[model samples]
Target: MATYTINVNGKKREVDADPDTPLLWVLRDHLGLVGTKYGCGVASCGACTIHLDGSAVRSCSVPVGAIENQKITSIEGLSEKGDHPVQLAWKEHDVPQCGYCQAGQIMSASALLKKNANPTDDEIMGAMAGNICRCGTYNRINAAIKTAVKNS
Candidate 1:
């Protein structure tokens, strides 16, 4: 085991873990930030999506040792009061059915918006392509993205 300090949610967090430990486990198991969930355990599912240096990434496949000193933002850090524009838009659109993939969805959407304050529909679709919603709420997700853009 080795000690590594990483910046998460704008705070420096220290954890002792193996080099190859997935960042998902480091956040959920070591740091007790369970907001980032484990879905497929592979990078295919976006349930473990989080922001690494302002870009959305699948945490399940990212080793903790690889991200030292980088800024990591999980769902919990998206907003202080759970009222981020995307989150509010999500609620407004009622996007989640199962809600298992919503966090990742939100993270991906937020990252897209951050990079492009006004993304076209095609752009939005491209950005969210990697995230899969089992409940198949793509329409609502798209609506929420548009709403978030308007609110932003």
Candidate 2:
């Protein structure tokens, strides 16, 4: 095992893990940050999405050792009080159904908004295409993103 220091949620965190271990496991198993869920062990699913250096990434596919010095932001760190505009919009629009994919969806939306404050419908769909909601809440998700844009 190798030791690595990573910046997660603006905090410096140290963990000892194998070089091939995915960042998802490090955050959930090692750091006890379970907001980033594990849907597919591969990178196909966005369930393990997190922000790495201001870009949304799939933590399930990102190796811990390769993420040193990068800033990681999970759903828990998005807002201390859970009042981020996107989160608020999420609540206002009632976007969640099963709630399994909401965290990743929120993370992806927040990242997209960070880059583009006023994204068009196409842009919103394109940015959130990677995340899948089994409950098929696409319409609500799209509405929530629009609300977040207006609210923010």
- Residue-by-residue lDDT tens digits, candidate 1, 1-152: 99999999999999999999999999999999998989999899799999999999999999998996789999999999999999999999999898999999999999999999999999999999999999999999999999999999
The digit string of per-residue lDDT tens for model 2 on 30-149 reads 999999999998877699999998899999999987886889999999999999999999999999999998999999999999999999999999999999999999999999999999
Worst 10 residues of 1 by lDDT: 61-70
Overall lDDT per candidate, in order of appearance? 0.96, 0.94
lDDT of 1: 0.96
Predictions: Cα RMSD each: 0.6, 0.6
Each candidate structure's TM-score, on Cα atoms with residue i matched to residue i, is: 0.98, 0.98
